[model samples]
Target: MKRILVLLFLVLCYTNPSVAQLKKVTLEEIWSSNFSPERLESIRSMNNGNQYTLLKSNPNNLFSAIEKYDYTSLQRIETIVSTEDNSDIPYFTTYLFSEEESAIILGTQVEKVYRRSTKGIYYTYDLANKQLKQISDQKIQEPSFSPDGTKIAYVYRNNLYVFDRITSNRTQLTFDGLENNIINGIADWVYEEEFYLVRAFEWNSDGTKLAFLKFDESEVPVFSMDRYGEDLYPSQTVFKYPKAGETNAKVSLQIYDLVTENMDLVSLDSPYYIPRLEWRNNPDDLSIHSINRHQNHLKLWSYNVLTKKLSLLHEETDKAYLKIKDDLTFLPDDRFIWSSEKDGYNHLYLYSKEGELLNQITSGAWEVTKYYGYNPETSVLFFQSTENGSINRDVYSITLKGKKKKRLSSKSGTNSADFSSNFSFFINTYSSANTPPIATLNSADNGEEINVILDNALLRTKLLSYEISPKEFSTLSVNGNDLNMWMIKPKNFDPKKKYPLLMVQYSGPGSQRVANKWNNDNDYWFQMLASNDYIVACIDGRGTGFKGRDFKKVTYKELGKYEVEDQIKAAEELSKLAYIDEQRTGIWGWSYGGFMSTNCLLKGNETFEMAIAVAPVTSWRFYDTVYTERFMQTPQENPSGYDENSPLNYPELLKGKYLLVHGSGDDNVHVQNSMRMVEALVQANKAFDWAIYPDKDHGIYGGNTKLHLYTKMTNFIMKNL
Candidate 1:
């Protein structure tokens, strides 16, 4: 009888349709996609000028391979180097090819030191003998090949060192480099974040000298965070982080002679921040871009290595903060191209080697979003701008004299191009809200698609299987200004039955939340919300970028005031819709948007019913000096601006449900910001839900962590809002 019962159960399990259950959707499947795999990022043209190499990841092999592609046909001809083929070498996250293409520097085992600062183990791959050589047994930062490709220069232990590939000998250039005292060949935390500089050393045109920036941060106060691990005792990760009104690291320029092993400091007459440095066309001449403490004044100076003298070439000033661009390209003739907002909009400028302004390359109400390199042979400058609309980006080209402007991308959506070595071909990455990202090789002169690299057809088909809503793009009028907004209604949306609303935003200065772009991880979560019957919306408030300088800088001396007003007013108007539930409304944001959301819940208490703030700055005084002071100046100068607008000062106004989330290891906006707000709410006897993720950074992404966070947030919304 028991044998018969077991046989019957086995038959039922195999034959019955409902016996086997459907698989619960894993976060990995929801986040990952089966798009066409190809070599893509960190693309650079070989010195031969006919070939280029791209970093390729092989999922099956679980390793990275450097593949070289032909310039004409855009075909991956061969794998230059593959970590899987070697037994001794480890897999690298990133790599750089030397000028001669004989050696490749592989970066692996990377550990984040600070914002934009990383330490990694480097290995040199030799092509001739198929040998792999380790540059250093220890981790290092920003390893670069010499101009001759014979030696590798890097920064380790806060000092500069050069390793000879032939002799396997190491030479230390600066012995005075110490933590919080003398930093050689690398930038500090603030400079790295604000200036976007990582590698501080520059190789001279002839490979005879190296120029670097040394930061003296002894006077800077140290900010420490407790790291609670599984170990018995918690560790401390302490570093010098300058708050809004705190002291910054003193930076200076230094030059190192490779032949003599001698280092000397370059003297600049004015006190300024050396944001960028590069070797010019002349072997002995180097260009440095510096800004004042206020960041409104900028000066471009040339340093002659032979004479050890500095000459100011050009100066740019504005009433508002000066924008830093990566388009400072030096021409073969020593002339350079730089972009500035001095004309109220970002435009390109051409300057002579001696600081004479030649002509403006671009001018309009729109802003240039990207500056692709200039084709020196053809004299064409490639760039992407918002000429079509502020939310859209399209590629364009103009001559060096600012004449004969031509649009290279014919697509109406977001189109970005990565040109090849000889400017004959370019790889275009195009996408829109309704479409998945598509990458294709196209002719640079005429926008004709040649071949498709990634179409993401399978993912799109899978996405279509679920109930999804279209992202309805519209404009809202607030404070006599038109602001862009996008809304996603419920799949089974009914105009007669009101539905709850959830608004999202990232209201940082020069930021755009509503754009014609491809879907991200956040979009998938939003789709889940839409499927569950919720209205998702986002608005680009004032201070968002790509509009113009006036629109972005209007929040000067007032960070959250105008942004909160616009968002609240926009939400109020949105709630008037017959399909939206006015009473069941909520707002949530991360980082800057978190600041905006918290302020909205407090200041606009009647408008939004609930708000979730993730890693938010409760007060402007707690933010970094460069970002905060760019708009609000110093807290000493603007005390009321900092206090009156702080959400921590008005905890009593949190009338609705509030869920505050932050990561304990958020170095960008210190967890202190959220902790202070939590204390304030507790003191006011306000009930709220808050969670601190262990060892998570500002991004808050890790193994099942993002899914759990969103699930928690979803549960909160279902119960409260």
Candidate 2:
């Protein structure tokens, strides 16, 4: 009887009262603010890029202003700063300006100190005589402004200071800063968690030279933890973490000389890793870049500072490792502009200002995903790529001799943009997988559409009172390659019913999460696991990224070997579908997708039967050392590539049902990688379910703690899949 008329049409489509009156999205309306969305915050563009400014707030006067606008009629036009006319410091949260925008800084009460450091209560203001001042009563770090906006610098206990906007005094500048031993101008915690470095100083293209980076860390090696707050005992949080084959932190490269107050130190034929210093438009040139502790050679030097000489301008190497960005760009005849993948994909080149190779402005085989500058009076160039595919992203423009290209985003999904300092407008933003981001403003010469800045059409009419299935993206072909997936299911879905699959992934390396834009917060927690009945997917396997560089360095030195063999061969080919079920499989992830869902629940123990792993690392000789030796190069040079993709070196290849979350002050995947994978699954006796979450870090939310950790992983996926 056709399976009892398809189980009575899936029980009359769940007793259809208009599908039981729609409304299913709730985890307190996906963590409240009643579905927020209407953005365009913090903008910028002025310096005659024909005006722009933004910030905005006013919800019937709880005040917040900044305003300005008008990059070719995107409207508004004045107000520049507020909290109902700023009566001094009780209102600032952020601001910066001064490259002759005549001063601004502002900040106030900021806080956060790890993960892009902070700590604030600054304030300079003076948009021509409105004065303000403040800059110190302590709390600081990366304050800025000095491009003749007349001095401000900043950083406080780990040294570096300055202020003076007309002598409000405060010049300290480094007396061998101390803390966990001499840090100087910021960036210490393993160069701010592995070279995403946080203000280890800069200031030159005419604020009279500054450059920085000191960090001696008294021969590195510290690492402690235990914070457990509401203090009745627990206290630790130590520092200097080097990890993988340890000891780092000698790091030198200094500079400072605002009219010879002197500081010097630059001697590098291998500073081992400065990872970018920058100054370029010739104010006595700077550039820097460096790398190597086997980050496979990267150089780029140049130095100079009034002839203290250094010059080796370009060198790159890479038998698998050289990636770095913020693309360089000098060209006012200093001819720089970089971006490389050495002809295997990442494109754009043109070199010169003393480094040689002159042109290769953009090539094919996709990838660029954002470079966007160098109009040099329309010799064109601009970027953002994946030439319209690898999970979309468009906006192009080529031709610094790579000959005419074009595509300024006529969206087919994620667009991006933001221009205006003379690209004559841009803004863009866009979105897709059934759009809900819009943004607009356009016309970078031909991409038309001039206006609408943020049309998340009332968040697509409040997602039509809820129930949305959408997603579906596709690609698949499991282990032999073609990955990029995405799924969703359940809202009235059926192809003869079975469902329950799960699978999410991260497969890190060049990282991509089957992108196409919109809906994050884990896409509304994978649309609440597809409205509670399961399905959800996501793949982007084999070391993930826009298909290239030999599909992302073929998992280089084998970190989680071929991303855990392409997510256990893409969950055994999505459990040979027929509406999936395959014994209701499951998998989940968090840090490096919780080390690829604890190495696919112990090497895909027969294709996963449950897993969660929130902060997981479970050892790469306990991580950090420039992202685990840029793809596993040192545990004394790959101890069988870190104990064969560590899940705490195979806890007797545990078979299924696991949970293990973490946080106990994580500071980046350290809850000792889930208490050493719960002591190798209690010496391999197995049986799981774990969690920690006290003093949380590595994003273990703060309040209702990510809704009580997703309602305890939605009651352990309705009691273990």
Candidate 3:
């Protein structure tokens, strides 16, 4: 009987669900099962506001189909089109429905041009006839359906052209556009990155005129980089890039009249930067947001297309620099809703058509993180804020008159809502550090949940198999400030034993790292490091977002000075802990954080023993004029600030093991920054390692690229620290 019981116990041990030996979660499994597999994406509400379409991908394959759902029942009644039904045309990344919903523009084979720019082959899918036809033989940008839905306007090769689907003909709108000389319909690199605009041309309400910003980049300096390929010879990509203190492209506002085929250039009072231009509700009226050279003052002007007269609407001035937000919405009544930081926090404001300040829509110490949408019918404004905690976010709705604020999401996790067209309903995507993503359909008025789309049950079940540690959230006082921080200890952590510390941060202005949200690939890597007997930590310093204007703007005029100091001080305090190995500390970051990491290794050599910076901006002089000048005021004026804070100037201080990685094709934070730093370190006789990914962008993700990167980073951390 004892031998029989022993055999049964052995079988139970091998087959027990709870006590069975579990396998460690790999990167692929974590990423694949991270989100609900059946969640919808690119959900859009039709103009009628009764129905919506969700782009759902096949579970077996990623090929997508458009499924139209009733807003009331939340039931998908029919599939409009699927890639399997038509194999001649490739799957689409996104679909844009016309105003009448008679035609849909499908975007496919998208190749990213820059941060906000892409080239995609477009096809017009007729909903009534169930027919598909390619719009152009070549890829284009900003393809928009005309007001009548019979024509489409797109930009190709820097020129604007209008195509008539019914007539099967194309008409060129502008003949002056030339590559590397003049750009008519699309924004340049600096404007797209800094101002958050790419489609430089706008369609009038009547579709009779197109207002566009023409950029003459003749005076701008050409920045060149070598693009090494498998071919025998390497090629050079040169483009007009306005660096800090360099000459910017001369911009002018022009209007193209379809009726007269005449273009008129409007001259403003000041030779300032035209950051944004849009047509108002009234077809003839256009709004232009212009900023001065110093970027301290911004003026919003309304121009009459027919009369060619410009009137100043609103002017915003700051002692530092004014931020350009995405919440610029104009109502049918001509009153506009805009966001500003004039009250020391980003708040919504209502302005009349003629620039009369109506009222302050939102006011508080907490800034609105995202302006979802405004419902004029209900007079409610939906937005997301960090009202619960600095690291947490929740959706909220307030009356347009700045009264009766109500929290839409009841959960204590990170909640974000995508409102329907009429604001009657919203799709809530909620998650926390411990919880995976949960998507649901909710009523926007009373925050009543209707249907639960995805609960990520499989992911939770899979996570139960692995031995993992919870991310410990805390606050640390560094450089006279209490900074938010999170730490992940090893599964087998011992208080008596010293472990090497690994610090990660993304110290960009108006960016947050310590958030109450699900982990991404980077977090998994950090966990992997923790599993390998290292302590991982992340700190949101003064320059990070969500706290307030004072906390974020403290680093202005001296971009890297206070940020680097706070990080160094945090490391110094962290190293004092008895369980931390002070001599074996390392730091790594990407982009802005990369800039911070490189500076930390150079400035805080005594604290950090190893550092890795990916696509870092070693010098502000090598960055764009708009972003650089906004923070540090142009290198000509703030030469001392630019030079003293740059990592290139302190090469002799790089005494630790350094590894710099960059993508050869990175348009943003060009590879020049890393190459220059590498040259400086080489001249200083500093021993370091670097990997330049061929034809990769700033994000550096591709086929087997991310795995290779993680392996390389893992090897670096193991060998160095």
Candidate 4:
């Protein structure tokens, strides 16, 4: 009887669905697209509000096509163009419709230059005549149609040119453009990296005048990196990069007249950073937004073409520093919508075009996260905010007076709304930490569901085959603030057993890691770590965003001081948990988080036992001006602030297992950061491991790149922790 009972118990254990039936997730499958969620590809809403276009590939993968679908029925209405049919161009990837929808331009043979810049072969398709024409034989950047759809303007080899789509004639607008000294109609390296402006030109409403930025980088210093590819030796990629307190490129605003062939420069008071340049509704009035080097004083100057005079429209000042964003919108009458943090929260306000204060549109303790476009026909403004919760986002609509506000998204997770061209309908993408993305069409008026677009049910069913654990969300009161946090415990967690802990964060200013969103690629890797019996936790400590302006700007002028303190203390406090193994605590982060993780392992050596830093900034002096100067002023102005928080100044405190990884081709956060840290630790006789990915960018993602990185990290964790 005893032998029979033992055999039955063994058979029952093998048949258990929760333990034996689920498969373990592998690093290869996690980094691969095997478990990726289904999504809409290149969606373009038509002006009719009832139809939208989609770029889809056939099953054979030999041809690609653009097709239109009805919004209500979710059925294909017509095929716009196809490579398999009579379409002349081969497999276009991107499309741009003219203002009147009379023509479309497709981009093929595309190549990326940076994070936000690209070069491509462009072709224009006439919808009425069904003619396909190439704009340029060579690759160009930022090919845009004029307001009237008669001409196309693009940048090539640091110069600006205009192509007449009808006559097929090209006109070079600027002739002084050179390789690195003079950049016409395009942002230089520093401006592109920090200010987020690439195509440094804009066409007016009438399309007769073109306003563009000219960057003269003759005095700025250049940085170079050795690119080791499949070559005999190696090549070097060098570009102008202005570090902190260094001389920046001389930028000027110029306007070119197409009719008279006259070009002239505009004189403005914004000498430090010209972040934004926009044209008003009158076709002649142009707005120039500027801020000082400290970024505390910002002014919006308006210039009138007829009067030829510049006037200040508005100005914003803050105790810490002001943030420049793409939120300036002008109504038909020239009254504009502006968002500011003057009231301790980012709220919207209406301002007359003549610099008069009108009224505040929205007001509350919470911040308006997104400012959607306004519909003049219904007088309703759509936006997204944190009124529901800080970690959650919801869609909302309000009138000009901030009345009759309605929440369009009902789910409690992250809800991002993409409106149709006419604002008659919007597609709301809802996701939570425990749920996949579900997209549905919502009516703009009463927030009613019109149709279900994609639910991602297949991804959810596929995820059930693996051992998964839902992330536990909570709050940690550290340093007199209720910091938001989340933790992923082992699937079969037991309180009596102690498990190693690994914490991840990206504790940059105005950044958040603990949010209610679906899993990213990192989350899948975290789940794989959790399956290996490690408790993964993430915290949004002080200096993180979404709470209010005060909470975010507290670390200003001292970028890594309070942030590192919070992380160290938070780890110390979390070690007191019953299920946490205090002896084997580890932390890791990328970029800004890497900076913090390095400091935590040094300053909090009593608490954290290991750390991994990827592409970290070792010192503020090596960072750019627009971003680093905005937070910490200048190294000359605040030397102590820069030197005190930088990890390069103090490496003798290291006493734990440390892994530093970087990419040689990281133009944003240069590889010098990790190299300096490595030298410092090496001189201190601290034992550590470091790696460099050859010819990889800051994201460090490519074929077999992420898989190899995560596998190395997993092996390190298993060996050390």
Candidate 5:
């Protein structure tokens, strides 16, 4: 009998080794990037179509280089520049080539200023003579080489300066720039956070003129956060932050003439917001986009540099609000391509130089997610869209007239492309739920794979030794809409045994959680939970994007109402599954997702047993002006909309276990949100748990902070849910 049992055990181990050797994922490993896939970093196509440049770094020596590679051979042609060979050059992290490829700008000691703004010590390296010169003695922002490759323009201390390479002289272009009062050539805090504008300056084609925006934020309200660093006393960091309906920085567009040395402000009938500025193919003319205060009306204007006159190019007014994107592509012939949602879906439209409607370039029921570039040689335009499915993204090539639209990407999951300068070739990055990121060089004409750049085969092999669950994707009918969803069951899931269901979401406007892409950190955490016999799922509820504008904008004026309803309804529907334990349901999210989880626990108190919220905005009034007013107008105009959905007003209804967390140094969504929630819950005589990480930003990540936070959250889930 013992020999028979041993032989059976050996057979079982041979057939199912995964059961015996499968390793459970740990939070430390997740935060340590143990499962990270290899990636092609910072790929820049050279002016010559046959070659490209890659920023490669050696971690052991801390040396970095810009290596040139031939696209056809997929081999490194040469190291254009490296800190290892150049004694004068420090360890640089980023590099940008001049328009004529005569010089390259290397950025070193770079530090982030805000979400999308950075300041760094810069150097210009001449390719011909192998000469390197510092652009400024101090750190600068958005340094760009002139078209003639003679001068470099950058922003320093809110002021604009130009470095002349020929003369080796630096000239200050603007002197009125002051901290928290006036800013030149760079975006203000609200503009950077909302309109996604960082560097607010552009160089004209002829290199004789510079167009920039000046922000007078003297009257804007100031917000302060206490940064409890490793010091004796905490320091306060303050900046101008404009809330909804608050006074915004007075923005004005200005142009400087190098030949005449004169700077003049262009008047646009006192526009409320100057969001965009670009120089047309004709250096004499500049294109500008201005929006009104309510944000419903947008006007495109053409300003002549010599004439100093503005002409109305095109005007668009939407009932809801218009989103500002950097998709305005100018063709060589002066015609421009723009994307619009006039037909209920975002499609590309071609307009004449005079702003006359020529034709709709691309139209469909689905939306164009990204507008790549128009190849003038073949008149073929490439873009990524949701035509495959709302949850999936595929690359497609279309003509100028919108006919002959061909799908370039063959993958069914998330696929993005970076086209070469000549558009003859493109590098495609593809990823799916079951696959790590795979980058391949392909033909731009028909998307034929030419060479494999990186397949992440090692990461795939390492993951095979772990107990990873497959992310099953499907659609759920909830609130009369087919909502996209993905669920992860336990590795040894049994249909007869019930498991606790945890619903996760962001539920913010134009945010998607149910994407069919490779796993993120949160997805790994969900897998960890699934391995512990818990079912994890994510649903893209109403107010989420990729569906029609009507479905996404349905919750406008009421930010959290329909989204909360959809989550609660989806949870109820998911609870009906035979394998789900309806009584022990839970939810968690961060940021906007954090806001949703809090509301789900309170408003849907009967459905959710526990909730975890991280860096949540308890009220829309706490958000910035451009993002909040676009959807919910203002707190003064929409008082009921702000108060009715706010969880602060209904803290008495909280009947489940709740965990609230925030970073004390969060400038985006201040800690006042969590503090107020704490006070409200205390006043309501409710029991809950909350934590505040000192000196952490909205992301609340640095070193082992994310691991600690996840550990706390994991323990809470194991105990409560």
Candidate 6:
């Protein structure tokens, strides 16, 4: 009788949901596409509002084709273009339609030049004639169609060129472009890295004039990295890199006339940085955003090309610094929609064509995260906001007067939408911590569901067979602030048993790690760690975003001080929990988070027992001007802020196991950071482990790179923590 009762208890435990036998997640499966959720790739809404186009891959892995689908029926209508069927074109990965949808420009053989920049072989396909013509004989960058689709403009070898479709004539617009010296119609390394401007050119409404930025990097200092390949001698790849307080590339704005073949340089009031430029509804009115070296004061100017007049439209000043974004959009009548943090939160505002303040479109304590386009016919503007909650995003629509606002997205979590051009319908994607992404077509007017496009039901069902722990969301008081946090423990967690804690964070300014969203790739790794009897957690401290502007900018000028303090305090507070083992605390991060982790392990020497930093910036002095200066000013001006927060300054504080990793070819945060930190630790007689990946960029990823790196990291954690 005793043996039968024991067998019954064992059987009950095996069948129970809390202690069921489930498959453990592996690092190989985490890095591969095995757990990747199905997504609607490259969704572009058609002008008709009832149809949309997306890229569909062939089951045989031959090529991908662009197919049009009806929103109402959720059925594919027809294939627009196919690389497999048309042997004339190579396998194209990207497609873009002209303004009138008459022609499509296809990009093939695309290769990355840097972050947010790519060079590829491009072709122009005429829909009416079924003719495909290569735009250039060599790879080009940023090929864009003119308004009439008669000509295509692109950058090749740093020079600007225009290809006429009718006559097949390629015209060289600028001839002064040279490698690392003069860049025409494209942003240089610093601008591309910091300002997120790759194609530094724009075509006017009429397509007769082209406005482009010229980056003269002759005076900027050069940075080189040795590329070790299958050769006897390694080659050096050199390019201009402006460290903090260093000389930057002298940038100028110029306009080229297609009819007269004349290039005119626009005169301004000694602008320091021309971050953004866009043409309004009128061809003559071009709007430009310029900021001073401090990046605290920004001015929006309207330049009339025909009259050669420049006038200030609006100006914004912030005590900390302003973030330049692509949110300035002009309406049909030329009144623009802009987002700013002037009211202690990021919100939308409407401005007249002449730069007069019309009215604040949306206002509250929360933030308007995304500014979708405005529909003139219905006079309703669509956007995504955090009004529901800071961690939750919901789609919303409001009129010009901010009245009759309606929440478009039904489900909670991180909900985003891709609206049709006519604003008649939208494809809403919804996801939460436990749910995979589900996409549905909905009516733009009333937020009623029209059809379910792709729900990822299969992935959701498959996840049930895995021992994935649910994230426990809560707020923890640390350093006199309620910081957002989430934790993942073992599936069969016991209140009496203590577990080793591993805290993860990316505590950069205006960044968030803890949010109500579906699991990312890192979350899967955390789940794997939890399966190994480790408790994984993340905390968005003071400097993290979505709370408000004041909370985010509190760490300005001192990049790592408050952020590191919050992380340390949070860890210390979490150690008081009954389920947390205080002696076995560890922390790890990447990039800015790496900087934070390194500091926490040193400053919180008694707290964190181990740390892992990947591609970390050891000092602000080694970073770029635009980003670093925006936060901490110049290293020359704020010497104490830069030096004191840098982990390189105090290697003697090391009392824990540290693992430092970096890519030798890291152009953004160079390998010099890790090397300097390694030297500092060695001189201090502190034991540590480090790895340098040769010829890999900041991401440190390639064929087997990420897998091997993660495996090494896991082994280190198992051995140390």
Q: Cα lDDT of all candidates, in order? A: 0.85, 0.82, 0.86, 0.89, 0.91, 0.91
Per residue, candidate 4 scores C-alpha lDDT tens digits across 1-721 of 9999988887876676454567767888977777788775657899887888998765456577788998778899998888877647677778899887888888888888888888899988888888888999999998888998889899988899998989999999998988769999889887777778999999889998889999999999999999999999999998888999998899899888899898978888856778789999888889998888889999999988768898999999998999888888999889999999999999888898787888888889898999988998987899999998899999999998788899999999999888888899888889999998899989988789988888999988788778788999999989999999999988888999999999999999899899999968788888888988999999998888989999999999998899988888888888999989899999999999899899999988888899999999999999998889989989999999999988888899998999999999999999999999989998988899999999998999889999999888889988998
Please give each candidate's TM-score: 0.94, 0.32, 0.95, 0.97, 0.98, 0.97
Candidates sorted on TM-score, descending = 5, 6, 4, 3, 1, 2
Span of 10 residues, lowest total lDDT, candidate 6: 12-21
RMSD (CA, angstroms), candidate 3? 2.4
Give per-residue CA lDDT, model 1, range 598-624, as digits (tens): 999999999999998888989999988
Better TM-score candidate (5, 6) = 5
**For model 2, what is the C-alpha lDDT against the true structure?**
0.82
What residue pairs clash in candidate 2, if any at all?
370-384, 590-594, 591-594
Candidate 3, run of 10 with poorest lDDT? 30-39
CA deviation > 4 Å runs, candidate 6: 1-19, 58-61
Model 2 error, position 512 (Å): 16
- Clashing pairs in model 4? none
The Cα error of candidate 2 at residue 436, in Å, is 2.0
Please provide, for model 3 over 1-721, each residue's C-alpha lDDT reduced to its tens digit, 9 standing for 90 to 100. 9999999988887676456664554556544435333345667887766678988665457487888988778788788888887776477878888888898899887887878899899999888887787889998998988787888889999998988878779899888888778898899888999988899888888888888888899889998878887889999888889998999989999888888989888888784689887889888999998899888898889999778898999999988888777788898798989888888888899998888999999888788889998888878889998888888889999988999999999888799888778888888999887787898889998899998877888877766666566788999999888999999998778999999999999898878889888867677777778888899999999888888888998888898999899899999999999999999999999999899999999899999999999999999989999998988898888889999999999899988999899998898899989989989989999899999999888989778777787788889999999
Cα TM-score of candidate 1: 0.94
What lDDT tens digits, residue by residue, belong to model 2 across residues 1-721?
Answer: 9999988987776666354467777776776646656767657898788888877654454566677878767788788678677665456667888886877787766889898888888878787787788889878888887778888888888899888889898888788788888888788876677777888788887788789888888888888898868868998989878888888888898888988798888898856778678888878778888888878788888888778889888888878786677878888978888888887788878888888898888888898867878888877878889887889888988777888788888869888888888888888888877676778888887788877867878777777667778898888887667788889897788788888888887778888888888866667777777887789888888767777787888888887888888888888888888989888888888898888888888888887888887887888888888888887778997799888788887888888788888888887778987887898889988889898988889888877898888889878987989
Q: Candidate 3 or 4, higher lDDT? A: 4
Q: Against the true structure, whose TM-score is highest?
A: 5
